[model samples]
Target: MPESCRSRELPASLLTNPEMVRACRARDFARVFRLVKVYAGIYPSMIARRCELTPSRVGEVMSGRRQLQHMDVIERIADGLRIPGHMLGLARRTWETPLALATDGRTTPQSVASDPVAPASLPGAEVDSILTLTSRTDPSPSMLQALRSSIEDYWRRDDQHGGEALRPAVLGQLRYVVGLLKENRPAAIRHGLYGVAAELARLTGWTYFDALQYNQARAYFTEALQLSKEIDDRQFMANVLACMSLQATYQEKPADALALVNAAQDEARAAPGTTPRVLSMLSLREAFAHASLGNRYATHASIGEAHRHFDQIQRGDTDPAWVTYFDEPKLIVDTGIAHGRLGEAATAEPLIAEALRRENSTNQRGRAFHAFWLARTQLGLGKLDQACQTATDALEPAASVASERVAGHLREFYDELAPHREEPVATAFESRLRVALPMRVSGSPRP
Candidate 1:
């Protein structure tokens, strides 16, 4: 086949999507065909031609009038769609041969999944750009900027949905960026590359953290800190420390969390690039630590300090790109979350509800996270019916959000409702939970 025809592969984002993966796993080729068209732009005629089926047959499958059951036909579909064999519960495809497992032939779905920086996952330009960066000693400014923008794009997708699907692409990008560091480049280019590498590592850590993979998250976070130090980027180091502190809090190590935050604050103080948003973010981390430890007075104090820093924000203040998400809605939500952590239901409930209303509509993960928190707070107030109602409302969005952290929150709410599981409201919510978040609800381990 011509390279163009052979290079035809599904988009990494689509294949890694939880819904698409589930649909494929269940051999729901009808849904798979629909999602492929939506996400990969492979229309029915194209799918028919590629998969060796009549367009009418493709239409039938997509319309649920037919199913692809024959092993031979299934293999054809797998090879045509470039879907991993494992996803469809089949042996590895013939195209994914041992030689094809090489770094050069990253066309294999496993490679596209584990390390996604290939023609399959990236655009021609991006593939060319990364190859240039890795294969040569010096890379162009434009290429560097393109890579930096891709990092920004990753964060945007992660915020709206969740980081689970983005992990492969990000880790691949991280590896490529880190590889660039070994090559000799101009001082400015090298410095910029370090920044990209640091941020990518941080993002990798965050993705692992979202999935509750603490050890992996910490390793990447620590690497991010070291990479920041390579460029003497103290501000980035501080940010990494803050991220570590947040993860520690989630790990139930509040004392460790507080110490990390203090170290982060010290780094921020030393770095002249620190902005109010950065300070506010660090202070919020401090608040989370105090709250987790049930230090009510200290939690309130740190949150107040966070607010003070937040109030100093001004337009065009030149805050780091990473801290841009620390806007009003975030601060408000964190305050409520801290209150909820301390079991202050009355104060937490209204604040979290209002914050949810003000949250960015595209942030599905945020919506699910806050809704779970609100449900927990309501449960604490003995409003079992209201709690179950809130959770029921959240179930749909939770299905779309692949955050294990959010799933853990859902599990927490379920465990909290255990005592009243026989209650009608709780029973109804339980049924909904089974449908929406079955795997997480069952206490299954994160992959």
Candidate 2:
């Protein structure tokens, strides 16, 4: 073995962290070897020499063939490597258990640690058979259907409960589907899988963004955009770009947001017979970006474009599944908020009121968004009491759901009300607002 590969005294702390144990159990040999190598730089090799085995034994353990038989040998290895007794035991236990591939095709063993159940329904059987077959053959129609059904199940769970309950499962399913798609090289499967991947990435990004993990969200969105491009689905690409723009705007990067919106607009223009809803959505993103940059004229121009696009969209036009929720009234509400941000209270107030009224007949998630933005507009107009009430209303549904955008709007509304707390209207608003909004341990509104 090379001198650099020699083991040395390490810290007990390394073994305690579950991530490290997982790394070892998964046979991440390079990582384990590299960690020991790094430790050698800080400690002398004499401590390692005291152990019966050399650095090569550590390598053997990581490579999964070495059976640790003696307690003294394990102890000396732990002592030399500075791994804690309990953690060393855990590492040994993990090593003994055969590492199983997760359903997602990741090398990590399934955390649930239960026996596999047989497929129950036709769909389940189809998925099982496809997964088994794809281990050898190309993806078939049954495989595509199974994958699509799984994706649909994720959506159904999200719609019925909320993203919080479904996100982890959805992410695992996405990884599994991607693995299957990669393993089987059929064109149809690839195309379907790309669409599914883009959607999953978009959802994952949105979920992480809600959790205030911006970097993680951006990584997912970046992957989503790349997948959208691969499928040549202009509408999906535009939507993904719009989502990226929203993330940028929220992060206070207005210029980057505008750039994304512009790119999306170009993509929409190139798309054949694009639906009005999609065009309006792209325009809405552009308007928001312009408003964030304090470009009132550009914002208004974009708002107008948004309305024009919404007007042109026919009722029965084919739209992407993701965008089907948006309609003419929804487009109007979105444009109205853009106007509100541009300081057009006269034009915004009635539109906001109409949106709130329409929301009563809409989905919970959409209603929450409508309420949030309306509250924002109300705050802008110095209608503190109404703003607070609207904000409280918005938060009611949002608290039960897993949407970052809705929660963010509510937070912004709270921030806008912060400076005027002494005023009677603001005071009244604050009393109720504080109770409705989720707060951190520091008693500050959650971002």
Candidate 3:
């Protein structure tokens, strides 16, 4: 091997470097190329040859004139440069988890059987890639259990701080789980692996959705549906469809959203494991679609149906891990959101306020989101001072979260308050926005 491309193995120190870590996490290959030159003596030419990219294209990426997005290209880069797959949101590379020896420095059969994964591959809050952990090697029940725990932790963190930083890690885990699905397994293990992949895909879709990247969101949601369908997990399929419907709702496609919810309610209900919480969520989504379309009566009917389902909840009923977040507080919040969307601010105001009081304050994004809705509800009822105050209170929580969706809601409320811009309350809110959400709030009104 030429010295410039010398064996492709990056120094372990370089891999653990903070700058390189951030660049890899963000998939900022331009910076990665620069860092490689500084640390590993690999120039752009050698990179092009090793990664199978033309010199010109490599220069373009290194110069930040282009970005690499395709998964296949990413995989190639991971293999060629010897970057750990998890670093680039790909599956773990073959060389990463070599089954070389046991803790005692001997290749014991029992050790390989018991410890198929390196400690680095353990699933945690970071959702690290674990190809050697849950793949064809062992696929133990504990491995799957740990992944589920990691996913649940992700959900908690996402609710609290928003998911912008979580995207890469989640995708890495998702890729690893998808790789696990390729090997033949027992029926139960296959089913379980598919479910985990679907959940991860759904989560990736949500992070994209929260960032307002609807196209990327829809693609992941579709992938989630496909994975769920592969296992005939109708309930999970319904969940993924509902996620797509929510994206459509946000995109202002009420009809499309309605069609998705209708399919979920009609077909997914037949799944043996379907829970009342699932039905309640589907009904709420239907209400959102109807409310968005200004179908007031239909919206009310859907909300009523949602409540009917919510009341069916029993302590012993088996609910999927993902859907457990749709508890009473969230249900109330969604119903209030539906009413607010339908322009029934008076009805929404108290409901939103009560739900907020009941909601977990640790969930910063949720607090900020519901606060925006509550402000809108108050504004609709002609309570200008109250609305502004509510919006002002939301800024702290919103600042803690990194969600474009929350920022959009704040901007939306500001836009609606434009007519009353001259009022002292609106002006006060605008000043606060300029300070708290400097990027979201222009110093002046939108042109």
**TM-scores of the models, in the order given:** 0.70, 0.67, 0.73
lDDT tens readout by residue for model 1, 1-447:
433344467888998999998787556889999999898878887787677666666776898755555567777788888888767656667666454356555474353322222232223444544643564546679988998899999988997788877766676567667766765889999989999989998998998899898987898899899999998888889999999999999899999999999999999989986899999989988989999999999999999999999999888799988888888989998999888888788999998989988988888888888999999999999999999999988888888878989888887888888899899888888887777777664654221
| TM-score (C-alpha, index-matched) for candidate 1 | 0.70
Q: For candidate 3, what is the lDDT?
A: 0.84
Candidate 3 residue pairs in backbone clash:
none
- Write down the RMSD of all candidates, one decimal each: 14.2, 11.8, 13.4
Q: Which portions of model 1 miss their true places by more than 4 Å?
A: 1-137, 441-447
Candidate 3 residue 120 Cα shift, in angstroms, is 26
What is the Cα-based TM-score of model 3? 0.73
Give RMSD (Å) of candidate 2 vs. truth: 11.8
The regions of model 3 sitting more than 4 angstroms off are 1-136, 442-447
Worst 10 residues of 1 by lDDT: 113-122
lDDT of each: 0.82, 0.66, 0.84
lDDT of 3 by residue, 237-261 (tens): 8888888888899999999999998
Model 2, span 61-95: residue lDDT tens: 54553433344555555544445433432223332
What TM-score quantifies how close candidate 2 is to the native fold?
A: 0.67
